[model samples]
Target: MAGWEQTRRRHRLVHDVAGDFARNGPRALAAWRPAIETEFGGLDDLLRDVQRRLHTAAEARLDALIEAPPADLDTSVAAVLDEVAEIYPDLRRLLDAHASHPAVAEGTVRFHRSVRTATGVDLTRTRSDRSRYEEKGPVRDRKPVFFARLRPVCGWLH
Candidate 1:
């Protein structure tokens, strides 16, 4: 790809990764809390350390991008952006490294609250799988209620 495309792709990737973490990280932690605690019952200190490091690393990545001056796409800018993308995988891995523990999940209640506030959607709404699907006959509609609800949260017509 061209240099500009590479830079744009990196920025997009960062945006995607951060959003994912912000949105799902809490639930992931909450979902597996029991297992996390079970496996590391005596490691609260370690888990806290890991969580702190992970948060710091994520912040550092954002800080780097935020501190960067706006520049028109160019070869140098592309290189820097690519370098930033290079750390994406590592950041993801770190953020999720302690996801196997129950304590982390328990700890994520606060995180989930913050994310919900920022996104303006309750986690229950997004995480729910309680909707049932019904088959529609010919010339009939299916899941009108479910689809209608989805429009408000997902903001689109089905």
Candidate 2:
């Protein structure tokens, strides 16, 4: 399967698990509170670190690119844009690494089981079994789009 497809599946699984926990309400939250807080806090810290490093790296590269004015300004601009685009794969790999860590995986499975037991819902069930709880069709679709570039970030800037 494509990388985006795998990423989408992972996100959907997270959403479904969250929904299950939500349905179970406060008690479920209480049961998994520590794990949730720890995991989310860890993720936050990781993101902050990444953001700081990215800022430093981008600044240094941009400074160098500015200092050395290439003959083709458009090509230089494109190179910078391409370099920024390349960061997404690195970020994805970092996330994938964190998700696949043994402790994280084990914790996730344990939490998922707890939520499933609390809610009495089995996400692993076949479509026919799931159909009882989940309505079919696009309206009921929970799968998120991989990437929907519907508009420019700041149209006003243009």
Candidate 3:
């Protein structure tokens, strides 16, 4: 099937499964869970793949900076930042999709707190700032400039 058709089918499947679960409760959900996973597992897999790729790229970038700092270090750093900027939206989408699930929501809260404690960076604050920009207009207009400014910090960290 075409991609759009597959997406539509999945959408219908989700609605049907949800309706069934609501009407029939836990027993129905238990029966349907495997099918639900079969249909939706690819998304979770894709998110994991993206995360692994991002981690590898980040490590490679950091290694490059440590081994032989480039002449135009800012540009090198910007490239890595740009890669992160590109990948982050997909991660956000996957997380947002699962945010309604109680377990996922609780885990996300714990992870956010851990990150804040470890990195001294408040993800909630950053998310809020990003939201403000999104509300104003297209992020494409601002992303490049924001990443450009961020390059200096990246360089300093290295």
lDDT by residue (tens digit), candidate 2, 1-158? 69766545434433333444446543544564454445444444433333333334334444444566567644443343234323333432342335555544554356345434533434344232113222322222342221232122222322
Please provide, for model 3 over 1-158, each residue's C-alpha lDDT reduced to its tens digit, 9 standing for 90 to 100. 59867666555554455455446654655676676677667434433433443344444544555467666644554444354434344333333344555554555466456545544445565543224323543255444532432332122221
Q: Where does candidate 2 stray beyond 4 Å?
A: 1-42, 84-88, 92-158
lDDT of each: 0.38, 0.39, 0.46
Kindly list the per-residue Cα lDDT of model 1 for residues 1-158, writing each as its tens digit.
Answer: 59766445433433443444446664544544454454444346435544443434433333343455344323222223223223333333433455557756664555446434543334444421111111111212332212221211111211
TM-score: which candidate is best? 3
For the record, the alpha-carbon RMSD of candidate 2 to the native fold, in angstroms, is 20.7
| Model 3 misplacement above 4 A | 1-36, 39-88, 124-138, 143-158
Residue pairs with backbone overlap in model 3: none
Model 3 per-residue lDDT at 72? 60
Question: Candidate 2: which pairs clash?
Answer: none
List TM-scores for all candidates, in order.
Answer: 0.28, 0.28, 0.35
